[model samples]
Target: MTLTLVTGGTGHLGRDIVDRLVGDGHHVRLLARSPGARPDVEWAVGDLATGVGLSDALQDVDTVINAATYSPIARRGGVRPVDFFRSPSAVDVEGTERLLSLCQRQSIRHFLHVSIVGLDDATLPYARVKLAGERLVRASALSWSVVRAMPFYYLLDKMITSFAWLPLWPMPTTSFNPVDTSDVADHIVACAFDGIFGERTEIGGPQDISIAELGGQYRDARGLHRKILPVPMSEAKARGMGFVISRGARGRLTWADWLQHRYSVTHQAA
Candidate 1:
C-alpha cells in the first residue's frame, strides 16, 4: 500500500483528495501549517512557506499529492498586480523548490502536482509559477504526473458576488470549462495509483461557456433577473488570460447542472 502525503491537505481540493485516498484504503497524511488534526488521517504541522515539519510529513511516505496553491484568489480583495509577488508567487516558488528538494532526498515514488487548465503556457503569475514547479518535478528523478483541471465552480460564487450590484456587468469575456471539485478529486486519486504519466492530462467541464453564459446560469439559478453583458477583453488581457483551455477528458457536471443541484429550484431536497 502506498503511503500518501498530501500538501495543502486542508484546502478545497485537498480535502476531497484525502477523503478519496482514505476511502481507497491508503494511508493518508496531511501536511499543513497548524490545526491539521482530523479523525483518521495523519497530520504533520508543516508550513510550506517556511519548510517546517516537512521531514516528519514525508517520513515513510512513498507518494505526494501536492494540492497546495498560491494565487491571486487567496489574496485579500483590492490587491493590485504589483502587490501579487509580495504574497503568492514568491512563497509559491520557494515552497515548491523546498518540496522538490525534500522529495528528491526521500525518493518519493510518485509526485502529482495539481495545476490549472489554461496554465500550459500561461503568462499569469500563478500559472507561470506552476509551470516552473512542474518543470522541476519532471527534471527530478522521482516519478511525476501533472494533472490540469479547469476552474472550480466555487469560484463562480465570487464572480457572481463581484458583478451582482451592476445592472449591466462589464467583465472580461474570459472563457472557462469549470469542473466540479468532486470530479477533479476522483481523477487525481485514480492518477495516484501505479503507472504514473509524467505528461500533462487535462480535464474540463461538459461544456465550454463564456463569462456571460456563466453569469446567466447563476442569475437564473438564483431566480433573480439580471442582465449579463460581456465586456470585450483588451488586447493584453485577452492575449494573457486566453491561454487556450484544452479539452481532452471532460467531467460529467455542467454549469447548469451544478447550479441547479447546488442552489436552483431543481434540487427540491436541497
Candidate 2:
C-alpha cells in the first residue's frame, strides 16, 4: 500500500482525505502540531512554522498532501487584522517550502498542493500567499499537481445563519462552481495514485451557481423564511471584512471575494 503523508490531517478537508486514503487501504500518516489520539491513523507531532517534527513526519512516506490552513479571519470591531496573512504564510507558504524541500530530498513521487480557485486575481493576502505557494511547488523538480477547488457547501453553512436557527447565506454576484469536499478528496486520491501528473486542475461542483442562488438554496433546504440578501458590496468591502473576521473566516471569505470579483464580468456575460 502506498504510504501517504498528509499535513493538516486534522482539518475538515484533511480529515476527509485521510479517511478516504485509509478506506482505500493505503497507509496514512498525519503531521499535526498537537499530539492527540487519532486511533485510525498514525500521528506525527510537527509544527510547520518551526520545522519541528518534519523529518520524522516524512519518513517512509510516498506522497505528501499539503492540506494545512489557518483559522478564519474575523473582525473585532472594524479593523482588519494582520494575523490573517501572517499566520497562513507561516504555515502555508514557509511550512510548505520546508515540506517540498524534504520531499525533494526523500525523492517523494507526488506532491499535491491544495489551493483555491481564482487565486491569480485574489486580492486577499491569503490567496496571494497561496498563489505564491503554488509557484514554489511548480519550481520544484518533484512531481506536483496544484488542485484548485471552489467553495464547499459546508463553508456556506459556516459563513451565514438564519433567524429560525437555519443557515442564512450571503453570496456575491459572481458565480461559483462549488464542489463537495468529498469530491475534492476523491480527486486528490486519484491524482495521488492514478492520473495525469505535473498539471494544475480546477475542480468545482457539477453546476455553477451565483452567490445569491446558493444562499437561496440553503434557505430553501432548511425551509426557512429568512431572506438571502444579495448585498451589492464592493470587492474591497468584502475583502476588508474578510481580514477583520476570525482567521478561519478570513481565508474563506477573502477567497470568496476574490473569486466573485475575478469572475464578475465573465459571470455577467454568461
> Whose lDDT is greatest here?
1
**Residue pairs of candidate 1 with colliding backbone atoms:** none
Off by over 4 Å in 1: 74-87, 172-174, 234-239, 265-270
Provide the global lDDT of candidate 1 against the true structure.
Answer: 0.76
Write one digit per residue (lDDT tens) for candidate 2, span 1-270.
668899878876888899899899889889988866778788899988889999999888888888886544411211146744553577777888998998899999889988777665566676677778888888999998877776565565555442235334345665556656777788777777875677555666666556677666555444457656575657655544331111111122333443454345544210
Residue 112 in candidate 2, Cα distance off native in Å: 1.3
Residue 85, candidate 2: alpha-carbon lDDT: 52
Write one digit per residue (lDDT tens) for candidate 1, span 117-197. Answer: 765545666667777776776787778898888778876666575647667765557666778888898889888885857
Error of 2 at 242 (Å): 12
Candidate no. 1 TM-score: 0.88
Worst 10 residues of 2 by lDDT: 243-252
| Candidate 2 to truth, TM | 0.77
